[model samples]
Target: MGTSEFMLAGLVPGIAQTLDVSLARAGYLTAAFAAGMVVGAPLMAALSRTWRRRTALRAFLVLFIAAHIAGGLTTSFAVLLATRVVAAVAYAGFLAVALTAAAGLVPPDRTGRALAVLLGGTTLACVAGIPGGALLDAAFGWRAAFWVVALLCLPAFAAVSRVADTPAGGVTDLRAELRELRHLAGALLLAALVNAATFGVFTYLAPVAAGVAPVPVVLAAFGFGCFAGITAAGRLADRWPGHVVAIGGSLLLTGWIVLALVPGALVFLVFTQGALSFAVGGTLITRILRQATGAPTMAGSYATAALNVGATAGPVLAGAMNPFRVAAALVAVALVSAVAGRSGRPAGPGRPSRSRRR
Candidate 1:
């Protein structure tokens, strides 16, 4: 699913040529997927609330696979765009359900690690899948990449079938989930702000590093940093989520500022920013899950929505202003938000404090 979501960027030129659409129009396919994720996360979670986790996951994979196949075979740009949205909706629901189920499989103390493992797939996609898709498109065609993604989903479907059919717990009421979301508004906001900072800089990274370093090397550095950050976050977040957020946010803010001030350090700053961003991001996710124990079925959906909101908004925000400076400002706001949330109240009503949890 992660591969399918991101691989489209590399194939946009080919798609535009084949469909006789403008490059800008072909780019809408990416935005459409993000929009679908933002809308579909909560929508699909609500619709599938009554099903077993395993069942919901399988159902989503089926839809996702069919959408990919349909997209690959379609010659009409409109039909292809519709298939992207459908696939994104399935991807959103599968991600939400999978995260919730992954957390359930682990003990409370190990929840951070479990979430990290699940999120690793996405980071890996950035590091590898995007390039692989490009290779496939070069050797075969753009449609071949879509077909490959559909084929990959088959194994995922079979794997999900073997997982335990855990009941989707917690109150199934949408009203109840909304109430939980209110209590979680602060954490969710923090998640959005941090990702906005991350993606705002990342979307413009190639141009930002124009002469300082090769694009491929700069991207590789950032991807490697993401992998390292997530690996460390899985362990640290379990014990010191607050500290992780504070320190990671500070580093991210500093990295962005340095990049803005000294454009020559673009490569190094991109790596540090990526590391700090994902570290804070992973910790924030664990924090949200801990606070949303009462809304187990909807927690992942809320997180997905918040993250995609940032992903969609970040590029638009960056496109309007100086990307690095904009990113730095966003991270500063996120840090302030995190600090205020920590100093104010507990994560949510009836949740245990960190001291008590330990």
Candidate 2:
């Protein structure tokens, strides 16, 4: 699903040029996609409670495949935009069901691992699908890239059909889910703030890279660093989940400031941006889940919603900032993360302080 969306990133400049639209209009492609994610997360969660998991998964994939094909066939930008929303709806529904299904399939001890695998698919999608789509767009028309995505889903759909079916859990109790929300204020607020900072800086990553070093070398360095950071986050989360976020956010804060101030260290700048991506995508997801501790279902939905919200907001905030301003914003975010980390410390062996265990 992420790859499918990233595919649009490569296509947007071309699409805008082809359609003779403003960049802002072309930008709506992202908004439309994200809008779907925002609306879809909760809607899918609500819907999943009604359908059997396997049945819902199959239906959502089918719809996603159909939407992709529809998007490829459309010539009217409005129609294409609408089709993208359809694809988003399908994507959101599939994710909600997929995560729920994964949890059901695994032992409680392994839920984190299961979620990590699901998220890893998205990271790998960036590594492979986005670049591949860009190359396809370069060779053929950008429309061909959408067609490629439409074609790829056929096998994905077939494979999804093969997963063994499980019995549905109790009817999704929305009231219970609603009750969980009140207790999650700290986690939710922290997530929103973290995403805003990460997205703000990350949204401007390419420009930040170009400003610091030779663009080509910077890109390669960034990709390599992202791979390393993402690989490390899962293991780190297992031991010091909270600390992992603090460390990751701190790296991002420091890195973005360097990129903004140094102005000619592409390698280091790229390394930092890559770290932000890797940490935000990896540890941040885990952090959101951990915060949702006792409320997996609602947490899953809300986390997904927070991700969409961040993805939506980051670029807009970044776009609004001047270079130095962007760096300052990142530093502010880092500080907030550090403070949140201090307050969120879980009680562990030999760590009780005054007023605890009273």
Candidate 3:
């Protein structure tokens, strides 16, 4: 699913040519999918009360597969955009259900490990799947890459259907989750900002890399950093999560600075862009999930929605900014996390602060 979601990154040039659109307009392909996830995540949670988790998963998985095929076959840009939206709906639903089920599949002591494995699977997708898809897109055409992802989803569907059990997540009160998100205003704002900064660069990496290095090398580096960063985030969250987030945000800011200073220096572009990718895809993703501590049933959907909302906005925002100026958003992310970490510090002798409890 992660692979499918991000495969468009490498294919931007090819897609732009195929659709007769500008590279920036081609970016709307990503935003359209994110738009669907924005709506689909919450809708799935609301619908889950009556739907069996496994059945819903299977259904969504099938829809996702079909949507990819349609995307691959379409020549019309509008059709492709519509197909992406449909695929995203299923993509969001599958994630929401799969994550909810994963937590219940283990004992309380092992829940964190179980959830980490799921997130790791997603990171692994970035490491291999998205980059590999990009390679295929470069070699063949973008549509051919879409077909490859469609085929990959087949085994995933079969494996989950055969091996996974359906765990019924109790009905999540939507109103309550909204209240919790409001209570977590600072965290949610940070999550959106981080996502916005991350996507702003990523969605434009194709054209941006053209001005810097070989497209393949840049994509591979970006994906590798994403995997490593997310892997580190799990370890960080186990100990000093607040500190890690602040540190990640600071690293992200540095990455943007490097990009601004040396956008075309191959070595620096790879290193700093990779680092920026790491912070965005890894720790920031975990940060969004961390904020859902107050709402279990709505946690998966809420986190997904928050990120998607930013994801939807980022590409559009990037479209309007000079790539060099994209760094401005990361500066904001760094400052916000610094403030959050300070607030999370131990407040008194016996009592911990709200962020510390997180």
User: Evaluated with lDDT, which candidate comes out highest?
Assistant: 1
Residues 22-89, candidate 2: write the lDDT tens digits.
Answer: 88898798889989987897687676766677788888888887887777777778988898898898
lDDT of 1 by residue, 67-153 (tens): 999999999999999999999999999988888898899999898899988888887777666677788889999999999999988
Candidate number achieving the greatest TM-score relative to the actual structure: 1
* Model 2 TM: 0.84
The full ranking of all candidates by TM-score, starting with the best, is 1, 2, 3
TM-score to true structure, per model: 0.95, 0.84, 0.80
| Residue-level error in angstroms, candidate 1, position 89 | 0.5
- Model 1 regions lying over 4 Å from their true place: 346-358
User: Which regions of candidate 3 fall more than 4 Å away from where they truly are?
Assistant: 9-28, 73-79, 106-116, 121-143, 162-166, 264-266, 272-281, 284-294, 337-351, 354-358
Q: Candidate 1: lDDT of 346? A: 61
lDDT by residue (1-358, candidate 3, tens digit) is 7777777777888999878999989988877877889999878766774566677778888999999999999889999999999899988888877666666566544444455667766656656766777789888888888888888888988877874555454555667766887755565556666677766776677688886678767766766666666566555555556566666666667767766776765445554555545444444445555556556666667667766776777777888875546645655655766586666656787656675565
